[model samples]
Target: MRSVQRVDKCLAAACLVISRHAKFCEGARAMRLLLVTPIYPPTRGGIQTLLYQLTASLPGTDVKVITAKERGWEAHDASSGQLIKRVWVPEVSPLIRNAMFNFAALGALYGWRPDVVLCGHIVASPASWMIAKRFKAAHVVYAYGREIGIRPALAAWALRRSNAAIAISAYTRGELLAAAHGATLPPIHVVSPGVNLPDDIGRCDASRPTVLTVARMRDWYKGHDRLLDALPLVIQEVPNVHWVVIGEGKIRAELERRAKAAALLGNVSFLGEVDEDVKESWLSCAHVFAMPSRYPEDEAGGEGFGIVYLEAGARGLPSVASNIGAPTEVVVDGKTGILVDADSPPAIAAALIRLLTDADYARKLGSAARRRVETGFTWELVGQQLHSVLDEVAIAQSGP
Candidate 1:
């Protein structure tokens, strides 16, 4: 905790001294990389976080980012490292924003002439494809489960044109290949998501047992519906248990209505889109973390990897996850955290009951979760793997 605080203070202070420029860090690698994506910081989301971490620490590489012009986001991103070129094409219609961004990225690609053009988001792959081919750069696409599943045709076109891919998890890789419907797919590097680990873990308050779930509420597969249903039953078992629902989405009003109708107003909290400090506070204070995410009946729109589970684990919090998708890979059945049937209210309630009722056992699991993260899921390790994979692709495709 002390180390993290010191690091935060130092980083914050350095931000004031540093100007957001295109200068390469000393000893920056020889790679000339162009990252094209729709979303970037300070837009906020899992994708943005992953992209930021991946791009922020690269050494010796001439890096440039071309992202969509999201108001209030591009300004803060300069501090994130590399030269940011926001595709600020005006749209006559609001719905055509992506098209505008695509055209802007396409225009910038011809002159930049990067050795490797990576698609930060799957949606950015098409423009990257055109530019990579024209510039003779290795075209690499990132396959996140829903981004491909939602737009199968676009994903297919991008995948076919790309040379390689970076899949967030095995589940995501499988989902992408399945979404392809037998189209020839490129090599997928199964690089699981990582989280920032805390140096010190806050002690859990036995009296006010809190269950934390951080996710976009608009996502139906996130299983907020099932969690809400389980809450009443969970309250029956652990009367003092409180549920903290973090992050905002389209269904916030509906979820609030349901909670109120169920008379769980006081027990439930909706801390929508909290800052890092508040998020850290909640993660530290919370006793147990639960996000009963599941895939739809069509087996679509699921977690590629439960990064929030990793985040909770990193914070020394035990997770209660659904036994669907990549959670089985990230969260152990009993060692780190417990996994229950997806969308099963009874199972969720039972799991929560067990975690909230047994403090010693819950702490044991939390400790193990922390150990798991320390050994396997840190940003350092993830960055190393990602960098190596990208380097391999660039080297292999670099012409004789």
Candidate 2:
């Protein structure tokens, strides 16, 4: 802690010097914004999607990305408007990859200096702060729930140094506050993720009432097991109900085995990691979207903001989600979707059954959800909010 304080003091002194010399000419030229993230598109994760959407949504802002190289990234970048620089780092070790990425980010800032630097993930936080400080640009850091929850000290350190911060949800904001541990922090804006309203994607098989869950099976907190447990009860009520699972991870084989053991093979289909169009099509046809994520026993991690719920909601599908975490904020209980105790298989089962059987009620909720997304959760709105924050921070950093 003492060491941290000393480092903070040193950085603070350096910042005082940089602010006087930092020249920000904003009116005539487009705002040059640099995004430093560990992962980018074709990686298929929430942060990647968020950064990608952010780039597309901000029209006048000149956006550039610095991220680690990923498979098929070149093809994806070829079609993009913004310049994306992929730093080649060995994928075998995360520590090496992150360390190399930071070093690369520091040296990579050669030709163009951005007016603002946004760190997409915590791994890039320090480098982002240094770069922003060097340019006298506004430094912004984003906080996601699990990352902060798992490493409060690190989160606190990053937040203290930033000019501003963005939290994906109120739940994530809470996590950031807790991480501060009574220490002062920068203005933390709660910017819930936005979803794209999909085109008329074709539908899935409607032979039976279908429930869909889209989440990586790598973590236990996503509550796939609980959903699997609820399936038997749901099957008892609606025997022909089909449960389609998307995403792939190490634990998928185990979840499949558990489903098989529970005699849910006939009812459940594990379509591991399908294309985006296919996932959207399932969302369009599925009667209910369910991924009842629960906090682990240690309470170290939970959903920051369940974007999948909004995605399903965008497709006019009512969700059955856990009553805890950011899902409560995303899925309005008894309004847009049914929220239940994720630990209680019966509760999950009941919600699923209720949505499946009562078409009128489900449709009402689904329609409301679609309307909610249309009004509040569109990417355009997200971009505007973010743009405002960036402008505010940049102006403040460039004092009169």
Candidate 3:
């Protein structure tokens, strides 16, 4: 059985090679790559997850990650073929942060002298640009929505200087291009964050009306307050509704207080900082996933792409997200999920109520949502896309 499975895997690889019209398996060869980010795993967030995924995906690639020791880099090593170097940066003050970041980045570049640098945050933009300029190495920047939208001048400079830039969603790409304002921008690509779909939605009852949202309890960008405000109306419409909130943040206390104030304490469950297994269980158990993220003052603090929506969708669960930033890209309006106007509590409430009340409609949307993720949003596919981008950049840089 094991031999047969191995044969099947080999055949699948052959088919992929043929389909892609490749002369050789480009991924088999090791390439020197540097990844810079603000955060990394054991620390929860999209950027951290993305960096880990990118590095882990490329097996033979010599990958190194440079990040600030904000919470202290844990669950990674510098000697496991994948190097993780943490620099102490005072995140509180801008002046100190910039100085520390520049010094640290320069030290990393000087020591490693990697072939390519893939920066994961805009805070590292200046350092990345300088390293690329000085060493003449290929630099690629990953632009999440908030970073690109907030630091327009820095983003523009990085976009112009970097060999290429990757946007997590089409919305982000559009915003980046708009910010550039006809300036010759680098080659930009959209590679949506991927989610691992569970084999079975364990112990979940589809008939029950359960709503899930996996977002930090932040008052501004995450819009948990708005969701809470909308809950009363939703409960009036679908009285049996239950909400599961899976995340931890500074605003958790405030949100809990608000839930009590709004008379939603009994209906809402706060499961703080759940692991992957627990998150999957909740995703499978829930009927719908909702996150109403809103942009905070046109700053780079909006949802670049709500990956939780896809995680829920992958489990044949529909989503109800705000029509803002990358959530608009993640959730297909009326198909995979509903997209309501940002900051409109009534609109959010109405959408959630509609999904809970209409069983058949919700099921259909969920089915479509699952199929969408299965088709294009898996980590395997995302890794392939990134591999191609890296190969192209490498080849271009090696040219006469």
Candidate 4:
């Protein structure tokens, strides 16, 4: 059984490599893809970023993105030469907003008549499936961690309806299979997120520990509070340890208040919504990247592959991520980085301490992590995998 599993993995990796090379090979035709995402560029989040990268990588493909235009965003324009369309919808009142946006998306998709519709996130899946059904177009759904957890009825319906489904991590794929309860749904493709590595690598010093986390200031899911709680313990072990958080969200002020209350304000700094250069700099300078994600009741948001882990790894920086959701796949325990129990302050702090004290060990993990991503997770690779999936769906749909 173990040998079979190993063979399967090896085959999958080889297929990925072959497919990637084929995409760059001569005489490759790009498929017209319609991406249905809840949010797109100008909207700040991992999913949005992933869609942006995927669209950018697929050359010669007529890519059209359908997304909601939240406040502070201008009306959509195809200025980038990509077919972009935005439907203005109310951000407030979830019920009405979803209904209106989905209806608008369906209308746009029917009129545009894309060869395939790729929906990002389960919430958008139902609408994408509906559009596909109405137009008899092929449909694929992208499931992140939270969408597959415990399997909500709507998510299940969406998955069952789509021609194929893509999960960001193995952890998420397992959860989705379990949710299906032995019932065959769609073909599940595990495509871990990718990150652009920096050209120059930085050195990690054991004496002056630098801990960094790049995530929105969302509540328990991002685990800002838990990181704050662990700070005191980390500071006790390494007095000069500094924790830097990048990105901003709704809970920014509240998290700041909590950090101040815990007397962690001095040790922690919040650098809100940093640009790519600054983010890469932070990842390079940091000795360890930590994120202790906790499952929230809503389950709409949770750690999904934690692309920041890959970003950190690319910079030759080891990480300490929580043992929850898709983070387990991104941070290889005792290999790429340390994985600790979720929401446990002491466990998180201890992991940080270990990484800070053991410079050689940390460097080894960082090197391995960087190699892992470079070998498997690259935008070119991801784009190739996606194109292959699209081709399969298109062929299957055109069957006699």
Candidate 5:
């Protein structure tokens, strides 16, 4: 009886604390959040999707988003249902665009004096630093893979002055620390991005196995060429296997030409930029999802975190992520899906064959993958993690 009373008391105290936090989120006194990013919806990708969900989840806070002008953002903004100021930068050269964006951010700093300024990428570190120093506000920056480097001394200096930094993966955090060496940097919090979990996408069509790879053919790192090389081997084992490639990029024609020259054109379908619903439908139809991604040979470009694996999992599809970089964080090697040497054709082929050939194993991995997303990598969970981080920063700044 005494223990039960103690538990009740503790619950009441917790509730009181939560209520106080709730008030901080709900009024004119709410935390003023300023988010600056180079990309956002309707330009969908891991980073944009994460920012969208995280922003949506943090309702009741005074949030302001400053981003570059893109085609679909107007539509997305209409659907967002939020009444925040949306600053748009005109399309131009990289340097000019960054200058314009920073100028806009500078204007916002003087006008609003945000309580916290959160930059979606380190590219805007200088603007974030200026906001933090000019006004007594917390400045935070996010580091994604391949985006951090040594050349931008100014950005690095800005990052060093930030109140905190968020890394999408442990690998990325390590990369950031190495890149920002010799600078007085703040603690980096590893916060993996999340996906919106879906209901079971139904069982795969066992009669005709399908392997889907969805990614824009923007760079060589996507490993589309490697996957194509493995196609013949995969076809040898699973005769009727069909490879579905969904995404559009400047190199699409080149990839298609290669597929045709190799006489594998009939087995492959390159569907350009697809609707969200259509993409989900394809995920539902796929038995296995594969993206043999790799790090660029030229420079510091690697997958910070792959959200596509989680998306595949949500649709009850097993993933075959590359055994490289932070993919290990998303796909649990044998449990979620097989991890193969992304650069090796034979390895990619073997992994794909194993998943498609053994229906029982594929289903088990798919189911496990879905459960993993539910337990950890959902958008709500990501938002909560970010919310907690922001709350911590706010609390520290409001120290008694």
Candidate 6:
């Protein structure tokens, strides 16, 4: 009876404390968040998808987006049901476009004010930094490993001004630290990107071994070339092996030429930039997902977080990824997927053959991958993590 009375007293005291600072608590709960990003969908990229999903998941918060105007954005913005401001940026000159975007983003912050200003990409950070200062809001930057090293000076300057930095993976967090270059840095938090799980798990076709690679062939490090190099070896062991490549880039012609030189025209198909339904269908039907991405000579060019791997995992498809960079954190070697030397064609080929031949082993890994996504990698989890970070910073800045 005495213990129960003591608990009641403690609860009463907690309630009194909460009631005393109710307004502060309310502000924290209904945080006004503004995202300044270089691009948003219908632009179609991992970062764009991430910002959209993360914003959608945060129903309690008031969110607005400032991004460059792209084709089909009006329809996407209307369907999103979120307040979005599109800035006109010319496509001719990189310097002029970037400068215009920064100034336009600044001008867009007219009527409303946000409690937290998020720089969705480093290119937006300078404008975000100025906006945060002008509004007396907390500044946060999303750190993807590759971008930090691309423009080291700008990355450092933006990071130094930010109150906090959110890294998409542990590897990215390390890169953020390295990019600091001895300057005092903001607190870095790792928030790996999430995927929407399919309602039904995909089953692989036993008759034909099919490998799927979905990525823009923008850079050689994306490992589309490495996958091509490995395809011949895979065909030698499992003839009639089919490889489907999705996405479009200038490098597509070069990759096609390489395939023709090897006389792999029949085994390879390039489905350029398909619809969401089509991509999901491929994810469902394919036996394995492979993008053996590697670290290039320039440290700035590499995978920050492989969202497609999670998409495949969500569909109960095992992945073939490089044993380096961000994939090391996303994929569980020997359990969720196979990780191999990204630079070695033989290593990639061997991993593919092993999964293709042993259906039972592949299924085991795929099941584990699906379970991992269910337990940890969901948009709801990302929202919760983001909310916690926002609350912590808001409360700290609001100091009693």
Top candidate by lDDT = 6
CA error at residue 206 for candidate 6, angstroms:
7.6
lDDT of 3 by residue, 186-303 (tens): 8999988887767775546645588888987654678788888888999887887888889998899988998998788888989999888788778777888888888777445578
Sort all candidates by lDDT, best to worst: 6, 2, 1, 5, 3, 4
State how far residue 179 of model 2 sits from its true place (Å): 1.0
Give the clashing pairs for model 1.
1-200, 28-59, 28-60, 29-59, 29-60, 29-61
Please, what are the lDDT tens digits per residue for candidate 5 over residues 1-400? 9999999999998876666465465543777788877777777777888877787776446777877668766777788875445567887898888887877766654467676788887767777678777777788888777776434465466567888888899988878777777677887899888887666567546346899999877777888899999999988988789999988898899999999999998789999999998888888888999997888668456777888888999887899888878888999999999998988999999999999989899999999999999999887788778878877776555444
lDDT digits (tens) for residues 78-122 of candidate 2: 988769888888866877778888988887777898888999988
lDDT-best of 2 and 6: 6
CA RMSD, predictions in order: 10.9, 7.6, 8.3, 6.9, 4.9, 3.7
User: TM-scores of the models, in the given order?
Assistant: 0.89, 0.92, 0.85, 0.84, 0.89, 0.93
Tens-digit lDDT track for model 4 on 214-243?
Answer: 887755578777778888898888888888
Native RMSD of candidate 2 (Å) = 7.6
Q: Clashing residue pairs, candidate 3?
A: 146-300
Stretches of candidate 1 exceeding 4 Å from the true structure: 1-29, 89-95, 109-111, 204-207, 298-300
How high is the CA lDDT of each candidate model?
0.82, 0.87, 0.79, 0.78, 0.80, 0.88
Lowest lDDT block of 10, candidate 6? 20-29
The TM-score that candidate 3 achieves is 0.85
Clashes per candidate, residues 3 or more apart or on different chains? 6, 0, 1, 0, 0, 0
Model 1 quality (TM-score): 0.89
Query: Model 6, range 1-400, lDDT digits (tens) per residue?
Result: 9999999999998876565445446565477899999878989988899999998887478899999999998899889989999999889687778888998899987899888899999988889999999988889999877787787778888889988989999988888888787778879999888988888774746357899999987778889998999998999999999999999998999999999999999999999999999999889899999999898886455898999999999998999999988998989999999999999999999999999999899999989999999999999998889888876665555444
Q: Rank the candidates by TM-score, best first.
A: 6, 2, 5, 1, 3, 4
- Which residue pairs in candidate 6 collide? none
Displacement of residue 245 (Cα, Å) in model 4 is 1.5
Query: lDDT score of model 5?
Result: 0.80
Candidate 3 vs candidate 5: the TM-score winner is 5
Greater-lDDT candidate between 3 and 6:
6
